[model samples]
Target chain A: MLAVGLLGLILLSVIALFHSLLASTSKSNDMTVATAMAQQRLNELVTQQPSYRATYGQDFPTDVLGQAVYAHDSQSTSTFYSQARPELLKDDGPAFGRTYYLEVQVFWNTPDANQVAANRHQQGAQSVKAGRVVYVPGS
Target chain B: MKRGFSLLELCVSLGILSFVLLGIFGVFELGQSSFHFASLRQGLQSEARVAFYALGNDLRHSSFVTVTTVPRTVSVILPRQESRGNQTLDRDGLCTAGVENWESPGAIDIHSGFPNFDSFVVYYGTSEPEGRLIRQVVRPALVGPYPNAEFSLVNSMHDNPLANSSRVGVTRTLSKRLLSFRARRDNDSRLVVVLLRLRGMGGAKPGTGARADETFELTLKTYPENTYPRV
Candidate 1:
């Protein structure tokens, strides 16, 4: 009976180790996808004309690269940008130019949402952000 | 009569139990190492992504982009705050000269009384072994042509201490464990592509045998929008 108990304990430990490894792998994959999607959005934003971009709203309409955009959550803020240096905007010197600060945040759902929530008091979604400044040449 | 096992039976069982325990331990060690390696690789990739986005944004918005062969540098001329008083002035040469003349100018003419242009440069620093990737920004300063005060300012920023100082616009280490850093302008001279190779530091623990020296290579490209006026 003692031998059987020892064998069972060893098996349980091995199973737990494998489970953790799998979870890590899954999280890594999710992060990669999120980063790529965020980059794509930023690239799109930079390519658009300044007039068109000024009309952008808070949320992006379509899904980004097949991943559903996370709903607004308290854990993180969505994509947005403000004037990095508002004082510079008021300058009427020879260097006066239009610069817009931009940021894009992307998030995706993870497979272990339930398990993570049960173990830790948090959601299972992973998120990444890409931010940069956009410059418009004076006409 | 059979209450206890004979000595021979006891010896055989002991041998089998020891072998089983050893096998289990070996498997556990392997699993641990694999987990560590995976985690390290993920971390490296995450760092690379952050560095790329930070640099790419600046490149895409820069008004001028220069890739100097010597010292292997990527310098970007960020947009400057134009004088509100000269909003109607033709200082950019767009109004005085036609589009053709504006495009043919050998060098950008910096009109006086205009605010200086800020710049950002990325290069490898003096960090030993695998050097660190350094990003240095020079605040608006009186600069002449291509290699002017701004260029010197950027070089000085690189050589200066990493701590925040008034003279230094903004200097920071972009990433560490950089085995190599290279930058070049595309054939059209419109895009700048940066290549970086990073390796993990420190060897795995003696017994864990985990992979501690994994290397990751990342390439990033960006097109500066306003470097050249659209004909």
Candidate 2:
């Protein structure tokens, strides 16, 4: 009887350790994918040359494991000055420029059904964000 | 009367127990190593992302780019009005007063004889095995003779800034842990490709057999959005 009890205890401990390891590995993999997706989306936005738009639509054509999606938005402002700074005036030209603020968010489905349901209203599951600022010539 | 297990049986049980415990410990060690490797890889990826983001942002807005092979430098001419900050300062570290307020949309009339650009250069420097990616922004003391003059100034700085004390710019360290850095411009597409290789610092202890030399490489291709029209 004692031998049987000891064997059972060892089996339970091994099973618990295996379960924890699997969980950790899965979480790490999810995070890695999320971060990569966020970076990719941010790069796309930077390359597109931000337009003077208040908000951008949430559309990511690439699908990650059929579970991850990405969305982006931008804020832009154009500032114009009546008088050019004298020091900057070489040919005494007028001055103007535009600034763009961009934010990208990537969302992925979580494995836990309960957690997914709880966060469904907040955008399905887990998410990661990347933001950037860009300046462009304006008139 | 029944007696306890014989000596042979006791010896066999002890041998089996030792083997099982050893197997369990081996599995635990393997798991630990894998977790450490994953964490290290994640850190490296995050660092590379930040470095690329900074480099790409500046390169994309540049109006002219000159890539030199010998020192692996990418010099760009960025419109002064489009630069991040409102004020432009000279080598004296003092802001140029009236120039700061200039603002215009679309491309500046470079052909119309307007002084409208700043010089920015990105290069790799510092000690090997642990180098740094540095970005230097040089705001000219005087406007006009620009675009062309700016290019020459940036090239000079890239070759050797220390030789000339009058060089005006702010040096910023973009990232560290660099094992190798290279940049080249594609002749056909006019896109700039930057290669960065980094290695992990590894474990603090000298001989714990921990992973101390993992390396990662990243290749970034960027298109300059505002290159000047070549006549």
Candidate 3:
């Protein structure tokens, strides 16, 4: 009877470890994806500086930054969202020939709270944990 | 006699094990699919970025070539033309499009002394699936005389095609789909604004279908000789 109990415990531990590994990898993938999406939105806005400067008088328009949602989950869409915001501007004070900005502040979401909790519980059965990562664009 | 295990108990245990394995496999497959899509989305996004930058560079340095002062014709000037820029377009050979030269390499001819200038029109319609095709018409500055006869420098992003708009048609295939196209001038009134939109390849929709409408916008800034700061 003791041997059977030991074998059952071992099997449960193996299952828990496997689940932990999968959850951690999924989180890692999500972080990478979110970061890339944020950067792309910022680049598109900044590259069009010349045109915007000519039309809107060199001031970075905050209202122009738009939001997008990405479906990344399975069985249901995993929602990944991002938006662009200006951080700095170098205008000529109305006399310069060109304008530049140190635009920043793009953010995106990771997986959902409930989803992460449930996934963590599944791994915790064998003392495994999910890996969470965050990325700030410049730093 | 030896006792045997009950069929019901055996079946129940087998069913539970199968269920556990199925759940694990299901999650694994889902994770794999998500990863693949994430990579594909990233690739398409990057390609779209490169396309935008390419168009933006050309637009920022756009120069207008003058073909005629009486009936002004303008051509977008490029730093250099590609060798394969020439393209012969024949849709049953009924209609033909070709290049028309300007008065000089970077001259802007005027029509009746007005600001009216010539432009290259690129036509984009549904033809290829999940691919972009562009056709540009190069109109010369003059019609006849020694100054005319289609200038020797045949310019194009693609190769130079037949000059005869009546003979072999002229068409240029762009690197991608032309999304939103627009041009305007700055407060100086001579500086020009050109906005170009290019479609992304390998998108969820490659053609003008339900999901293939992914596009990138590029903006370019330019100035006429009169508006440019003199060196």
Candidate 3 positional error at B104, Å: 12
- True C-alpha contacts between chains kept, each model in order: 0.04, 0.01, 0.00
**For residues B1-231, what per-residue lDDT tens digits would candidate 3 score against the true structure?**
998889998998788777666655654554444344445444434543453454334333333332111111123221122343532211110011222444554333343332222333333321222234344454555433323354322222222343324222345444444323344444433344444434433223211212222233333344333323321
Q: What would the DockQ be for model 3?
A: 0.05
lDDT of 1 by residue, B1-73 (tens): 6688899999998988887777678667666665665666676666666766766676665544344422333
Residue B137 in model 2: lDDT: 55
The second chain of candidate 3 has a TM-score of 0.41
True-structure RMSD, every candidate = 15.8, 15.8, 14.5
lDDT of 2 by residue, A19-99 (tens): 455445334444444555455445544544333132333112222223211110001111111110011112222244445
Best by DockQ: 3
Residue A65, model 2: lDDT of 25
Tell me the tens digit of each residue's lDDT in model 2 across B117-193: 44435354443224555555554544443344434433433334344344456676656655556666665455666
Residue B108, model 1: Cα distance from true site in angstroms: 13
Which ranges of candidate 3 are over 4 A from the true structure? A1-139, B1-4, B64-231
| DockQ (0 to 1) for model 1 | 0.04
Q: How many backbone clashes does candidate 3 have?
A: 28
- Positional deviation of residue A2's Cα in model 2 after best superposition, in angstroms: 10
lDDT of 3: 0.37
